[model samples]
Target: MFKDRLRATRISKKYTAQQVADYLDTGLRNYQKYESGDARPTFEGLVSLADLLNVPTDFLLERDEYLDALGVSVDVSLECPPRRPKPRKSH
Candidate 1:
């Protein structure tokens, strides 16, 4: 599933396998292993690949279904507020 998506996206973006390998700073054989499903990328590498492919990491991992199930919306401008600690109650 992951390999198919990676290959399809790479081709759709008109990127040669060697180009991707170079971008990822990995050898051609090592990158080929990723396509062959004989190896998996590290979390950092996954993020880098997703960035280069202009996709979310979940899409590369075939985990986007989980996000769809939750119906979560991605908004770059949304910022999370800091949480305040609760005051201690008197004994």
Candidate 2:
């Protein structure tokens, strides 16, 4: 569950696995294993990942679905303020 969420969140933010691995200060292989669901990170790693992913550790643990829904609302914004056009030049 954490693996899936991590991969999805990373991809959504246009980050490669290597980038995340670098952020975690772990080998790319280890990061790949996490994403493959073959292993889990240590407590520190989990917290670090949650911080990097901008999600709570509980979300990575899939402890609450409500959090996931709430995260979707906050992590990816739906709208941006409109930009006003520059004033036209006078003749």
Top candidate on TM-score is 1
Assess candidate 2 and give its lDDT. Answer: 0.76
Candidate 2's residue-wise lDDT over 8-34, tens digit each?
767766778899999999999899889
- Report the poorest 10 consecutive residues by lDDT, candidate 1: 74-83
Encode model 1's per-residue lDDT on 1-91: one tens digit a residue. 7877777677666778899999999999899878768898999999988898877777777776786887743322212233235469999
Supply candidate 2's per-residue lDDT for 55. 70
Candidate 1 runs further than 4 Å off: 70-91
lDDT of 1: 0.75
- TM-score per candidate, in order? 0.72, 0.69
Model 1: lDDT of residue 15: 77
Candidate 1 backbone clash number: 0
